[model samples]
Target: MSLNANDRSIAAFTMAGHALVHWFETSIPIFLVVWLAEFDVGVALFGVVVALGYAPFGLGALPGGILADRYGTRPLVLACLGGMSLAFLVLAAASSIYAIAAGLILWGIAASVYHPAGLALISTGVEDRGTVFAWHGIAGNAGIALGPFVAATLLIFLEWSVVAAVLAVPGVLAVLYGLGAEFDPTAAVADDADAGPDEALSPAALFSDSRTLFASAFAVVFVLVTFEGLYYRGTLTYLPEILHGLPAIESLALPAGLEGIQPADYIYVGLLVVGMAGQYAGGKLTNRIAPARGLAAIFAVLAVLALAFVPVTASGVGLAPIVALCGLLGFFLFAIQPFYQNAVAVFTPPDARGLSYGYTYLAEFGFGSASIALGGFVLGEFSQTVFFAMIAAFAGIGGLFAGALLVGGDRFAGTAETLEANADD
Candidate 1:
């Protein structure tokens, strides 16, 4: 796990970028509560508004991957940081729901490129890939936790608009750092005959590369991540809002200045803070175990947690048990990330690494984000039990796909690059 200079440099830059991405992403859920009150809209309508932003976050991953492959990770990474900062500034000036959606859409488009670019850079550049992935997840989890904490705290003093404008500062600083940061993006892959991304960006080449990718085990990983996305977005998007309604959270009180903060917001932040551990554990676990098995096991745990959510939250037993459940939920929710990310690397080639990650996230964020709308509708129309049940189903289905990979053994578990090397021999 000891990283040399290049690995450290890549890790530092990617970790900063990783944190910023989630900083913006996780903060939105906190904003959801505010948006609900300020916009005076029903949950279903507002959900669509959020989806307008999030859908593009997922939908744009493919082109982001293509651009990463064609142009290199640095430029896209820089653009992602710069664009996201500007998008939030746009949010600061928004006067209506439409303007908010426009700002979010811009943010999504800008932020969407980071994962494909950052992960691909690590997969190809960093020497200690799993270690870096662990650190990367930790950084993102930091943002996940801190973003809400900051937003919740700021909402105590400033308007949501000013808070968003304030949030833009870190990303702007990150961009300036990224501009001068140096590392060979292809360093680890340089020794391999097939390491570089494909040069051609033609439509036929794009189609062919995608076809070659889906013809392998990566296709299953894609489906698994989509379900991951569904469960993830569906559960987390309204979590603070959901928790705020809980008797456990509602009963709590804070001191004078902090009194404006919802007790549930703290719980939400606690859950995400615990995820940093889950992410690190998952990342380390990827090096020790089969990622497919890990994915299956983690998602199964998520299913059980999802099923337990309503029962636990509504039990009226007290804050301790609910807080514990949130802890477990936060942990396992993020633990699946590194497993699936490693699975992508195992199932695809270095040359197509960017596109593989692109498709992977497209399934995860793009298709998964639809659950935001679905969850909104479900929450609007049905009971909490039903919404959680839907989340359980997403987790169960994802677990099943991972189980298929486990059952397939080497036929599906073998790395694509290894098979290609063997075929060459």
Candidate 2:
């Protein structure tokens, strides 16, 4: 096959593998309490376990980017997937807490391998940057949207071990296909950079060293992405636990039909679906309104929803309204992604694009690791409601910062007004 066809197929496999891990890991959050009971693990340890899964992802992303640039996306992608499938297969037989944590950590390492390279591949491979990137974004979010549902549905009939084992199959398939493809863009980059103009392609650009503007923009986005991961992780991880707490959703939570309706499960599913819708909405509004205005609006919504989380915990209100609110919350929550992506895309340079992508995720998964720890601590010590409420504050602050970046200065502001003017033409 031609490079284009090969790239697309590889992209599909890469994305699918990435999404499967995303979906598979949701099981941890879904079966949080169950795992506790089955293994007798403590909350702190639980948090550590969860955090460890993502800890490597934050640390490994940049290097992975460099490696993908040095090696080939085709080989790296397949090896990573194969490694992850091996990790999941380990999950099926894990008899102790340490074993499970080990599996998750390895799996996380494996999962992190795909993004930087996969993105670089797609960005360089496809001729139209916009169409390819938009599709890539949609694929990622769609994975986030679908994985939890697939996980939760399987939970209805399978043991956690079975579920863990089953999730490995897709990765195996991804590896098989990935190994057969040939993509050598990084080699091309190496060759061209050597022969072309003496542009400064420093290692610092890819590693921890970032320019001032890039650093500032990265910090702003760190907050945004941290909250995004926190929200996504919390929703996927806690919904099942929340469902067990509320008898209302047991009937409705499953695909086969919830044995009962756990209003919380409905809320979880609602948030995901709404999040998917919100991404679409955000995409539509990004060019029409300044990202700052949209971000401000999103933050405002996140803050309200975060606070709302406490009341909706079935400790105070019924599940139905919370379920509705979950959908509403998701609508605004997931919509912020494009705005975030666009903001970063606008600020980053071509040479250091890998570093930019890596650090963006470093902020994402680093805080993600921390957030899981925090969520586990809170859920173990306090109410899930309170845990969620605190995240609201985090999400709110992140959104506010993003908004400020968009419009507070001469840099990102007045687009809303300008767009309005453009509409008149």
Best prediction by TM-score? 1
Q: Candidate 1 regions off by >4 Å?
A: 28-50, 92-102, 155-164, 253-259, 412-425
lDDT of 1 by residue, 14-80 (tens): 9999999989987897898998998877998988888788778888998999888888888889999
lDDT (0 to 1) per candidate: 0.86, 0.62
- Displacement of residue 192 (Cα, Å) in model 2 is 9.0
Worst 10 residues of 1 by lDDT: 416-425
Q: Clashes in each model (backbone N, CA, C under 3 Å)? A: 0, 13
lDDT tens string, model 2, 1-425? 12355445545654565566556555556656568878876888887887788677677876766566556455566767787888888878999988888888887888776676665555444433333344445556666656666667787899888887887887788777766666444332343332111134346532333544343555566567777777656655665576557544443445556445455555566566566567666755665666556667777777777787666664645557756776777777677766665555445433444555666666666566566667788889988768878778777777777776675434533322332232233
Q: How close is candidate 2 to the true structure, as a TM-score?
A: 0.72
> Candidate 2: where are CA atoms >4 Å away?
1-14, 29-51, 72-75, 93-99, 122-163, 179-209, 212-216, 227-263, 283-293, 308-320, 372-389, 408-425
TM-scores for all predictions: 0.88, 0.72
lDDT of 2 at 190: 48
